[model samples]
Target: MSHEIELKLALPHRALPALRRHPLVSAAQKLGNAVTLDNTYFDTPALQLKARKVALRIRRQGRRQLQTVKCAAVSSGGLSQRPEWEQDYTGAFDFGAIDQPEAAQLLARHHDALVPVFTTRFRRETRVYSPREDLRILMMIDTGEVSLHTPDGVERSAPICELELELEAGQPLDLIELAETLASDLPLMPADLSKAERGYRLFLGTPSTAVRAEPSAIDATQNAVDAFRTLAFSCVRQWQANAAGALEHTDPDSIAADFIHQLRVSQRRLRALLKLFAPALPATFVADWSVRLRENANRFGDARDLDVFHAELFAPVAPEGLADEASFSALASTVRRAREEARAHACHNLDMATQGRLLLGLTADLHRLTIDSLIQAADLRTFARLRLDRLRKRTRRLAAAAETLEPTRLHALRIGFKQLRYAVEFFAPLFPARAVRRYLEAVVVVQDTLGFLQDVDAAQQRLAAWVAADARLAPAAAFVLGWHAARYARLRRRALRESTPLLSGRKPW
Candidate 1:
């Protein structure tokens, strides 16, 4: 059995020419001949092997056939480590060379039922780079498609364009550094999805859905930097998972708006985590990444704003009469067109070259972060407590000043609440789950109320923009403006009432 350590990157097909001529790739030693790999993945009807997190595949290169079994892998920031056992694939199934007894047993039980599930045929160009003494890396550029044959004889395929950096020798950190340097000039994004995973997803016909933050288990004994890495990685995974969905669909009109929303939320969560750990982390690094994240997520802004207008402001209120209905219909039609335009703008920016680079840069930054003295000396519990108290104090002070606060100030309070909530969620395992839940519940009340107020303000702006853009939308926008304005006082009251618990709630930390 041999362990495989590699970093994967997803690139746009259009960027292939630039990548080929890039200094990094051009400087690397060309290793042997390029090979065309035809790989067939097998699994039982019930997908028992998939359930076990095992992959069985047979690859044909020229006249030689190789059978390989790969165990479950640990992935973070597009880097993966897994154990693989491979041997000559004769005609029949080969389990004798399988190193893991449990995997071997499981394969043998369902060996007869195993069938070809999917295939990936790609031409790979190989290059080797010696980053430094005693450290060598193999760079494989693969371009092709992953296809699955359904029982009904339908074929479904998704294009594949990727770069694999496999460590031939030396430390994994060295690999990360090399990747970061290469990506500094190239449009590259770290891809967390493995081809096998993508193939299985295609075979299963799984549709993408909105993903939320999962709980991060931080050991009390862990240092601050490691805990931050754990939280950062979790947030990165959520962001990338949603990003994959966004990239898979080409038609912006048909794409789920939640994909963009969830991606933004994930990016926001990472930003919040950075703020919470700013003192312990490199300040310059954190500041640079925050700006980059804002820039990247903001690319999807207009689409999201239009989506909110359609979903929240327009859909809820029905026209009272025919005149109102005509006006509303015109307004809706105009809004839909505007949404399509915005979606097009967003999609154009997110295609082949730009989509993955920001994400890859983010992943590379996280991988190369160095723990400062403060972080190394502090336990996660101590650091978390300090962070929570600071945010709580900031939140309360803002809530207290809410009476005379401007809309922007109120928005600031909402941001504070969001950060506090995310911090609580990130460090929930450090404290009791029940206590954390109570704290989160209180924070949610304040955050939701403020969020509604902010949304109303935004809706008003959207309505004004629509009315200004088209005279036909004037009456409909007026009706919406009147309807929404009347509720502002009520919304403010609710926000104030809900702000009580958050301002006065005992700190769980």
Candidate 2:
């Protein structure tokens, strides 16, 4: 499917309102007599997201281009969202547009008999763009009216402000080379901000330059358990979304790789949320599965990494035109052989039948957790209290469990901790939970220890590939020894910093 190139020039605020009313633009629709419906805005609060919008626009049938411009401006101050993606349709929509009313009457409603009114859509995104002074970017001036029409032909218009920029889809982003082929000549500047979230500009808020507060989380405890439950529901909803895409994945390798990554993240977050609500549930209830999933994720991650190295790094380095090029030609040949072996290793692990079975099993577990029956107890108030108590007790148990665990098994133990933490999260509304605040502090401590370990592990694997493939550059490979030493030193410091010992009892394993 080919994509359209769209350029939504963020109209200067001072110029937009007058531009809308200009004779060349407005007389086409006879706007003086049109019944205009005001603009409406939409967003998901739990996601801490705001939407920008475009007016409903259309062009006449015989009026040159069969397209209209649309807009959506957006901003955020919180941590980046986890790995979520909108649908992957990369198409664009826009053109020589007429006002909302006339376009529908002249082109859509009546032209159906002679012309085809195709809705070729592309996914729209609105993300905050920071300002850069070097670029002569357009500054926000003021808002123009955004009008809508009801099914009964009643129409309304509302004043809204926004900053908008549109571009042709799949265009190469060339800041230097070949920049002329795409949306070039555009400069950059600080987009101003507006507090009012409505109308046509609703998608691109009124522009201001004041720095915003880091988006602190909503105080779910103070708001009531029902509010915290909203987060729980959102998490479960995400799991279902993953499940819905089950069979549609034509590429098993990409799908498996994605699922494994999501599993790791879900486990980490679940642990964090469980810790928040741990004052309630039984510690034993979710501990085991956490270990299992984390181990599986690590296993899958290893396979995926090897897959990348095998595919990406196996090729011979582009000949650098060395005077003695043949001196290292054999080394490249050796690297290619290693790459084939690494690819075989990763592929053997990714046998779709086996991976699919694991995914199906994981999906079943998620369904069990998300089913309405498991959640339907009573009103939000009652549910909140019950969940709090269950999760609190469970958390203390997890904290104690973490105090034990052998070094080799720490990954597995963390998994157990995560599951209980997530279950607690599931029922967070029932308690006066200080989990989010407390855990935010605890995470740094845990990651400093555990995270350092994982980083060194990954780094070691990456550096080892250079040694295995480039024996001729043995000195350069040995040069990497300094980095290895640095990593080991960091690893030692990480080991020394954690207060918890790896073993509390006799080795059960």
Candidate 3:
């Protein structure tokens, strides 16, 4: 049994020429000529092994056959460290080489039921990257497809073009550093999916969808710094997943709106986490990432804003009874055109090289981040309590000021509510679940009410510009605002009323 530590990057097929032409690639010693590898993955008809996050595959290279057993591990930002067993496969199944008790038992029990589930055939070009005496990395470029064949002889497949950087000897950070250096010029994006994972998805016929934020796995036992690292890495996973999804489709119409929205959410969550744990983190780290995340998020802001405007604001307006049908139709057309343009812009700007560098650089920094000795000794729960208390107090002050209903003050209150809500969600696991859930439910309501108000306010400015550009849109804009007028006013009052109990109530932390 051996632990495999490697970083995988997805490369655009079109960028193969540039990658091969790279100075580093040219300088590295080629292990051999590219060879085709045909591999078959096996699992029970019921996929018992897959259920346990285990993969069994047999590879055929020339006349030699090798069987490998791999178990999934914590993979983030394209880097993974997992245990695997490999041995020669003469004919029948073999679990004797697998040292892991659970895996060995499972494989032995289901050996007879195992069947070929999927096949991956790819040409792999292997090279040895040895930049230092103590460092050795294997750079393998694989280009092929993962395929599934039905009983009816029909075949379905997905293209695979990726580079795997396996660390033979050296730190994981060096792998990420090398990836960052390569991504500086090539169109490389860190990919968290393994070939086996891709094969399973193909065999199961699962379509790719937008990745949403997952609950942070921070625990009470960890120090403040460790907890923050756990939470921060969670955010990075969300960010990386969405960024990859957004880049998967080149067509503007094919890009999902949720992809962009969730990407922004991840960035915002990361920024909030940095601020929430700033005292324990290096000042420069917090300050630098805050700005970078904010700037990157803003690139897609217009697309999301327009999506909400069209979906929530305009779609609900009943132009049937109160406005001219022609004017409303024209306004709708303008909104759609503007939205398409913004979407296209966003898709175009989602550059693989740029996003790759950002992810790899941030991931490398995260791996190298060191906590202050004093902070490392502090209790995470106590730290969470103090942070939550500060956020709650600040939100209470903003809520009080928002009673005047001043747009600016209301906006500030909205931001405060958001930060407070995020902090609550982040620290919820450290407190009593019931109390945290109740408090979180209230915070979401207040935050959502404020969000609606803010959206309406933002819509007014955009709608006004449209009206100014075309006089026919004035009546339509008026009707749109008038339609939302009552609810907006009621929510403004409700924002303050609902937040009172939440801010003044017993604290969860």
Candidate 4:
């Protein structure tokens, strides 16, 4: 991912499942024998800035197989903005105590919580015929001092804790039995005071923030939002990587087409993100920018979709005609003509000197725009209005250009159609997403009708050339050409009627 990544492990109070104690439930139970450790964590300057965490932790659990979970925290000291929020991400690592001494010591040094029970693992494993304790592993993430006390009797309930164990059906805690037992026998009870959590430390209650008389839900929505954005950024970055590799070689068609696909997906993320987070951001900011980016993106999308499909899909069907060969020369000829038309159109649409500049501008904008800024702008509504206007204007411009012949007008009209559809999509969400979905279907109808016709026209020309390259299929080539001409006319008529600009000014949303 191009964006920075931060991981934290947390068990929020709201996320806990409801608790019910059965007749077998023990007021005080024990984990027969298990592994235990005592540990603490700290924060450094760089780790604090990047992870928004000042402290780190590693906690160990289990006996025979020896499993350890690492946890980290961004203390309020490291967290500067939105004190109510904290970020967390988690993953698990296994330590092999059976064979490796290094793994044991490493666990001893880094692991903290449940250290007191480390010695119990041997006991738990030693029992030959007993059922395994349904132990659970969990972490509690508390932003404020959350009260676990019951309102009726003032008995404290466990708060801000996460427990993990693959439970059998209807059995929630083999581990809870152990926890309750340890609390009863030892001086430790569920910690009411809040402390920092880390890759290695255990904390409970209110974290660094002051405790509240009444607790509020942990607002990790911002963190969730950022994680999603980071993921989106990664998708776009893949295109950047592909586009870079394409630059290294000389196959313009393969390279340029892949780059365009990446561009299209990148634009899609922009579109979806704008819609998804519309509630959180300013009205039209994501929409307006979406329109602008779509303008450039559509030019590539139209040309490349056709070009790439033909290259990847049809090449297998007519490999011999690809160049000069003994292969099905007629089929190869047809494909070449189609490829040339689409490629020339995309390349010629922009001035030679400025091709990279226009493409880069769109990608750069996506990279630079911040999630916070997108929300603060004209907002989704106002932005959508502006985007629609821009798209409508562009569509009209292309409609005018379509007056010209074979390739030039076709090229211009392609650009117009892309921008117009995108505008409609931007507004589509304002109505029913289902209705917007229907509009996209109409778009496909137009493309299929027109696209089929264009395929025939170009195919006829290419097939004729293939016959010339290798005369063996001369008779078949002639038959195909005749079929293409008639089909081409049919498709053209369908396209012209379907894509009339009558709805261009309508309230698309």
lDDT of each: 0.83, 0.35, 0.90, 0.40
Candidate 1 wrong stretches, greater than 4 Å? 96-102, 184-186, 322-326, 372-374, 404-406, 469-472, 485-487
- Measured against the true structure, the TM-scores of the candidates, in listed sequence, are 0.92, 0.34, 0.98, 0.37
What lDDT score goes with residue 468 in model 1?
81
Number of the top-ranking candidate, with TM-score as the measure: 3
Task: Write one digit per residue (lDDT tens) for candidate 3, span 29-124.
Answer: 999899999999999999999999999999999999999999988888899999999999999998998889999999999999999999999999
Look at candidate 1 and tell me the lDDT of residue 430.
Answer: 92
* Candidate 4 displacement at residue 41 in angstroms: 24
The parts of candidate 2 lying over 4 Å away from their true place are 1-233, 240-260, 267-299, 303-435, 458-481, 494-509
Candidate 4's C-alpha runs over 4 A off are 1-377, 400-405, 426-431, 457-478
lDDT of 1: 0.83
Task: Please report the candidate that would top lDDT against the real structure.
Answer: 3
**Candidate that beats the other on lDDT, 1 or 4, i.e. the better one:** 1
- Would you give me the overall lDDT of model 3? 0.90
Worst 10 residues of 4 by lDDT: 117-126
Q: Which ten residues in a row have the lowest lDDT in candidate 1?
A: 351-360
